[model samples]
Target: MSRLPPAIFLMGPTAAGKTDLAIELAQALPCELISVDSALVYRGMDIGTAKPPSALLEAFPHRLIDIRDPAQSYSAAEFVSDAREAMAEISASGRIPLLVGGTMLYYRALLDGLAEMPPADAQIRAALEAQAEAEGLAALHRQLAEVDPESAARIHPNDPQRLVRALEVYRVSGMSMSEHRARQRAQKAGAGESERSILPYTVAQLSIAPAQRQVLHHRIEQRFVQMVEQGFVEEVETLRERRDLNPEMPSMRAVGYRQVWSYLDGDYARDEMLQRGVAATRQLAKRQLTWLRGWDGIHWLETSARDNLPRALKYLESLSILS
Candidate 1:
C-alpha cells in the first residue's frame, strides 16, 4: 500500500460548534475549509440554515456555500463532484482540505461512493407526497418501515423529503435504497482493492459531540430560540414569497426552514412553529449522531469539554497532518 495526500473531515451534529472549530483549525494549519452541509448551499438561507454570519464567512471563506439558489436542487452526486474538485484545488495549492458539516449523507456519498440509482421520478414522488398529505408522514414512514426498514431506521419520521424519496425509489425500481447500497458494497468487495479511495487524498475524520444527551438537547433548544430572535421567521417569510419556491422543495424542507415555512403557510401558529422547529432540530441531531457512530476511524471529542480544541489538535498531530 502507498500513502495518499491527506484531507481532514470535521463532522458533528448541529449546534456542536463545528464552524468555530474549523476556523481555529484553518488558522492553525495549512488548510482550506469546504462546507459539507446540504442546506448551506443555497443563497438567502442564512438565518434558518444557521449559516455563518457574513462577517465570519468573509473571514473564513468556506467553499461550496451560497453557490446555488434555493429554487435549484443539489444532489449527492453533484456534491461528490463539487467536493472532489474543491479538495483537488486545495491540495494543488499545497493546503489541506478541511471538510466540515452535519450533513451525514453528503459525507457518506463523498467517502463511500454513491450507489448507482435512478433519477427522481416526478410521478412517483407526487404520489408519495399525496399519500403523505392524505395519511400524514407517519403513515408513509410506517409504510417505508415495512418495505425498507434499514433506511427507515436511519431516516426520521418527520423527514418527509427523505421519506418520500426512499419510498419513491422502492416504487420506481422495486428495490429499496438500502438494497442499492448493498449491491454497491458487494460489487466493491468483489472488485480488487487497488482503488480504495474514490477521492485522491486519504481522509482523517474528526467528530465533535456532546457526552451528555441532555446537554446537547439543551443546546439545540437554546440555538433555535436564538435563531428565532435573530429573525429566522422573517427570513423564511421572504423565501416563502418567492413564486418559484414551495414548502415541498428540498431547500424549503431543511429542518428549521420547513417548520417556519409551515408557520408562514398558516399550518401552525408561531408558538407551535417554535416548538416543532426545535423538536425537528433535535431529531435531526439524533439522526446525525446515528450516522457518525457507524463510521470507522474517527477521533471523537466532547464538544462541551473545555479542552476540545487541544484534544482535536492532538489527534491531528498524532496523524502527522498538522504541525
Candidate 2:
C-alpha cells in the first residue's frame, strides 16, 4: 500500500445530500472540510449556490468557499492549487481532508491534474468577446466545433467563458485544447503511477445520488423553488447594483444566477426565470452525473439510505486508511 495521507471525496449531483453526508463524516472522523464546488467560491452568492449557512460554516469551517468576489474569475487550475495546499495542511494536522460538492470538473482537475496550455491573451479574449457580441455565442460554438469538435461537444454552447477560452487556446497556441489535453494524457500514460498522480493522498471517492432519476429531478426543482422563496431574486438584485459585474462573467453565468439576472434585465418575466432556473439546474445535475458515471473507483451510495455514514466508514476501513 502507498504511504500517502488519506483524503475523502464526497461527490454527487446538486441536491444529492452530499453536504449533510460530509458533515456527518467529519463529525465521525478527524477530517477538515474543503469545498469542491465552483459556484460556492464566489462571495455573496449564498442562496443560489446553496452555500452552507454562516452558522454552519462557522461550526464546520470549510475552506475555499466565498474566497472570490463575484466580479473576479476563478479557474480549475487555481482550484487544484488551492485544494492541494488545503489537503496538505489538513494532513499535517493529522486529519483527513473531506472534499464535498457537485463540481465534477474541479474534482477531475484535482485528481488527474490539468494540461499545460497557453496563457490567456487579453487581446485574443477581447477579440473573441467582440466576435461573440457581433456573431453570437452559437457562431463561436460552431467555430469551436470546426477546430475542436471534442471540446465543443463537451462544453455547453451557453458556457461563454469555457467556449471563449477554448477558442483562445487555439488562437494563441496554434493547437486545439483537445490536442493539448491529449498530449498531456500521452505523457502521463508513460509515467509510473506515483508520477502520474498529481495528488499524493490515498483518496476514497464516494458518490451519493437518489436511486431514481425522477427523484433527483424532483429534488432539483424543489430546491430551486426553495431558493427563490429564500430571496434569490433579491440576491441577484444586489449583485446587479455592482458596476463591474455583468451577465457574461463566470460567476453571473452560474445556473440559476444567469436566469435571474436575465429576468432582472427585463429579458424575461419572473415565471420564465423560475422555469429556466429549474431547467438549468437539472441540466447541471445531468452533466455532473455524466461525469461521475464515467469515473472509476467510486463508492456509490443512495441518498435515501440511512446507513450511508456507516457504509462510507466501512469502505475507509477496508482501504486501511483510517488511523
Candidate 3:
C-alpha cells in the first residue's frame, strides 16, 4: 500500500465551501488540483457553475477545466481517462493529486472501474425515438419495465434521455445495464490485485457539508440568488446566441441554466424562474448528500466549522498520508 502514490479526494455538495477548503489544503501541501465537476469542463459557463474567479484559477491552475465547448459532451469514461493521466503527471512531479468536486458519478467511476458495455447505436436510437413518438413516453417506459425493470425503477419516466439510453443498451446488447455491472463486479472479484484496482493511489477521501440540512438548504437558495445578481442571466443569454446550443443540451440542463433559459423564453416570469432555480439547486444538494451518506471510508467535516483545515490536516496525518 505504501508503494502507491498519494492522492486526495475533496468531495462535498454545492455551496458547502469545498472550493475554499480545497484551496487551503493545496496551499499547505505539495498538491496539484484537478477538477472532478461535470459542468466545469465547459468553456463559457462561468457564473452559473460558480467556477473559481479568473485570478484564483490562474493561481491554482486546476487540471481539466475549460477543456471542452458547451456543444461537446464529456462522459464519465472520458473523466476517468483524463484524470488518470493528470494523476500520473502530478505523481511523477512528486506532488499529490488533489481531486475536488461535487460530481459523485465521476468519482465513483474513477474509484470502481466502469463496466465495459456496448456503445450507442445510432440506428437503434432512431428507432427508439420513432417508437416513442408513435406510442407516447409512458408506453416506451412500460416497454422498458418489461425488459429492464431495475433501470426502469431507477430512471424516471420524465427523464427521456436516460430512459432512451437504458432501452438502447438493452437492444444493442442482449444484457441489461444491471447485468453488465454485476458481471464487472464478479470479474473484479476474481481478478488479481493489479488487475482489480482501478485507481492506483493511496487515496484519502474527505467530505464536507453543513451539519444541519436546513443550513445547506438556505445556502443553496442564497447562492442561487447571488448567482443571478452576478449576471448569470446574461451569461445564459450569451450562450443562447450560439446556434448550436439549446435547452435540451446537457450544458443548458445544468440546474440554474435551465431555469434561466426558460425565463428568457417567456415560459415563466422572472420571479418564478428564481424560485424554480433555487428549488432545483436545493434538490441537487439533497441528491448529493444522499450519495455521500452511502459512501464508505470517508472522513466527514462540517462546513460551519472554522477549524476544518486543521481537522483535515490531523485526519491526513492519522492516515499517514502527510508526513
* Candidate achieving higher lDDT, 1 or 3: 3
Q: Give lDDT tens digits, candidate 1, residues 136-244.
A: 9999999999999999999888778889989999998999999998987887777853224666677889999888889999999999999999999999889988999
Name the candidate, 1 or 2, with the larger TM-score value: 2
Ranking by TM-score: 2, 1, 3
What are the TM-scores, per candidate, against the unseen true structure? 0.94, 0.94, 0.92
Superposed by TM-score, candidate 2 places the C-alpha of residue 146 at a distance from the truth, in angstroms, of 3.1
Task: Give me the runs in candidate 3 sitting further than 4 Å from their true place.
Answer: 130-159, 193-196
List runs of model 2 lying over 4 Å from the truth: 191-196
Q: Please give the clash total of every predicted structure, in order.
A: 0, 0, 0
Candidate 3 C-alpha lDDT tens digits along 246-314 = 998888888799999999999999999999999888877877887789898899999999999999999
Error of 3 at 291 (Å): 1.7
Candidates 2 and 3, the one with greater lDDT = 2
**What's the lDDT for all of these models?**
0.89, 0.92, 0.90
Model 1, residue 59: C-alpha shift (Å) = 1.6
Error of 1 at 265 (Å): 2.9
